[model samples]
Each structure stands twice: as C-alpha cells, then as structure tokens.
Target: MLDRRRLLGLAAALTLGACATGPSIHADYDRSVDFSSFHTFSLASDTPQPGAPPLTWQRVSDAINRTLQARGFTRSDTPDFAVGFTLGKRDRIETWNYGPYYAGWGQWGGGPWGPSQTQVRTITEGTLTIDVFDAKTRRPVWSGTATQRLSGPVSQAEIDAAVTSVLAKFPPGSTQ
Candidate 1:
C-alpha cells in the first residue's frame, strides 16, 4: 500500500538510522598473551596515512588516549606496549536488482512485484585500525578496527565513540 515516495522515505530513514549507530567495531588479540601484564603504553612513532587530513591523527590519538586512560592504563616513555593506528578509506558500490524473476508487470498485476528495477549506490567507507605492540618484542599483541560509511565531516565525539567501541574488547577475557 506504500507509494514510491513513501518507500523512498522509509529507505532513507533506515539508512540514516544505521549511520547514527556509527561504525561497526571489531577487535582481535593474541589469546596466548596476558593482557594484564600490560600496564603502561607509549604512543608509537607510527603515523596515519601521510596524506591524511591534518587533524585526523590528532583526533584519533586523543580519542585513544582518553579511552586507554579510562581503562586504567598509564602513558610512559618506557612502556609495556606501543599504541598506534592506521587510517584508510575506499569506495563501496552496492547494487540491488528486483523482479524479472517472475511473470509480473508494472503495478496492476495483482502481484506484489513491479517492473525490473535496479538501484546502485556508492558509499565511502572509512577504516581505522588501532594496534598495540609489545614494547620488548616490538610485535603486535592486539588490534582493533572500526569501519563505517563516511558521509560528511566527522566530529570528535564520533571519533571517540568509534575508538571506545573498539577498545572495549581490550584485555579480552571471560572476565572482561
């Protein structure tokens, strides 16, 4: 019973709702490593993509700093772990094709189908990867990634939320 305008509006609302939830966060760590032993961390010399926007690294670093501090970690010159991140983006294209599979016509067929239709959308997806390396081994012990569709300029709170969501899995264990 929905008209074309109504259907389009509903789709837009659903897309916006998905965007509001921000990015999807994922984390992975060496199960053999004891995260409890990690008490102090230092910002690694690693930098974001050299061509990245000037403030992207600053914002990401600040957000990571705040999140780690809140999780009972300290910053030190000679640290247990080195924290770093990488930023990247890519264009994603999604296409949806409906109909042509059934014997149906546009409207009035008494069937719930329409004419063969196709919708193609391109979304810019941004990825942020946070890595934690053992200072002594200089190898990664944990990594978290956040991926989301980028629509416009991002805000600090959004950055913080993305960082927080990823690191929430830190010190991964049954107890945590």
Candidate 2:
C-alpha cells in the first residue's frame, strides 16, 4: 500500500513539474478567410504587464512567429492584418498543498485500511496575452491568451509551445 502512495506522489510531482504557467493555447482558426493574404505585422501595444520574471514575453512572440511561418506567413513591410501582443505573469500562491502526503491505498477510506492524507496542491500562476489587430484600420481585431500555474522555472521550449498552441487559433478568413 505504501508503494502505491509513493507511486501516486511521484506521478503527481511529474505532472506538476511538467506543467507551465497555464494551459497551452490551442491554435484554432476560423475557416472563413484565407490566411495567405496575411502579410506584415505590427505591435498592438508596447504595454507590458508584470509576469513570470521575463520568461513570459519571449515565450509568446517566438511561438507566434514560428507558428505563423510554419503555416506560410512571411515578414513583410505591408501585410493584411496587424499583430500585437503582450506577455505577463503573476505570482499566485494558494493554500492548496504545496506539498502532498500519500498514506497509501489502504490508508485512504477507498482502500481496505485506515485513513489517508488528503491530496492537495497550492499552484503558482502566470498569464500571457496576444492581441491581433487590423493593419489597414489599425483597430484591434483578434486576440488570444493563456494562463497557467507557476510550477517552476519555464524554459524557452515551454513558452514557445504555449504561444504556438494559442496562436494556432488565429483567424484566417472568417466565416463568423
């Protein structure tokens, strides 16, 4: 029974460690407009929010650009729509665990034994936002964001993934 608890604890730790500041922004797009026309990009706002130290910005932009290029977008002087984004994270701590103790299967009421420690975890948090705008009109058009708990130091790879996941939703044509 103790072995099971240890296994459960270890699995939970792996999940926590693998987790970033928030859920990955899955790139979903409106199949209305054609994405090929998209050219040129611009910053919506230079405003920066207080986020996970600095791992925030690099994570968002790099991911967006990479995703766009992968889908066949080129950096041009003039383009279809304007792109603007902001990155930030916040220090979030909850009374939630921060630590977990497993008493084993038998220890829990579920098992055929005694009581077990309640499973809980306090998660730190962070958020990222990307705002897209109409280039010709210079008005905000589409935007996407992602927020997650701050488990630990975020690497460039994770940031890129989060950004990629979110921007994948960028509207191309627009049926809606």
Candidate 3:
C-alpha cells in the first residue's frame, strides 16, 4: 500500500525519471583504438514497431554507430558488438475514485459515503542495451542497459537523445 499524498507528490518525479540519462563511461580507452580493431558492429533490436519512422531509425542507428566508431569500435562480417533496444507501455493509475462522503448525516457511513477508494496506474517503459564482444574469443566483454518511459511515440530526435544518453556511460578502453 502506498500513501495517497505521497504518491501524488511522486507522480511528477516518476515522469521525469523517463528523461534520466544512461550510465557513464569512465574506464580507460577500450583495447580497440579504432573501428577495425573490434571487427564489426550491428544493431539488434526488438523495438515495439516493425517499420522505421520518418528518419527515426536511420537517424538513431547512424548516431549510435557514430558514437561507437568514435569510441574506437569497428564494423565487420560478424559484429564484435551489437546494439539492442526495447520500448513498451505500462498502465499507471495516478488517481482513483474515493469515498462518496459528505461528513454529515450517516450512522453506518463513515463520511456518509457509499463507495471506497479505488485507483489504477499506467506507465510506459523503454529500454536500450549494448553488447560488446571479442571476435577472437567469441565472448561478450561487457554490456549495458538503460530503461525509462516512452513518454510517447518517440521521434528521431528523442531516440537519439535516449541512445546518446545511454551510451554516454560506456566504459572507456573496456576491452582487455
């Protein structure tokens, strides 16, 4: 059970959480100083929709690739690294029907009411995951995930923002 007043206060806070950024990259530069060093890169996604939006997929993917390239990750036959993401919605009932009370003229009715308090909740969630591996060893070296709200049918700009925010936490020089 949650406190009524407290929950109301947290509504805005949770909404803002959707805008929260991803992790941070503080490790040394990865072993792969250049894109070629890793092998190849590909994006693996299970995004809610199939068809890409106007400039949304292209823009977001390109930006993600660029970010990886800048970080020294390369592109190849079998990408040594893979990028994946997901988006979804969850119902959150912010408010509900409370007692029909007047605070007068009622013996059994606590507040002269007829009904009790009831509410439903709805929320949306989005997630991004990045996987890095060693081509030679055929093993994943590291991976990261960032989850938040869709807020809406996110635009290309929004996707970029989300991806950028998440990748910003990639570890530096992650490879051994």
Better of 1 and 2 by TM-score: 1
Task: Please report the TM-score between candidate 1 and the true structure.
Answer: 0.79
What is candidate 3's lDDT per residue for 36-150, written digit by digit as tens?
Answer: 4444677654352332232444555676787777766675557765665332223444666666563344656355545566777665444445555555564555555555653
**Each prediction's Cα RMSD?**
9.9, 11.2, 11.5
Tens-place lDDT digits, model 1, residues 22-89: 78888899888888899999899645445554466677788889899888899899999999887766
TM-score of each: 0.79, 0.57, 0.50
- For each candidate, how many residue pairs have backbone atoms clashing (under 3 Å)? 0, 23, 23
Write the residue-wise lDDT of candidate 2 on 11-106 in tens digits: 322221237234755333344445555666644433333322233444455567677777666755676776666544444444432223343444
Point to the candidate with the largest TM-score: 1
Model 1, position 168, has a per-residue lDDT of 84
Backbone clashes in model 1, listed as residue pairs: none
Best by lDDT: 1
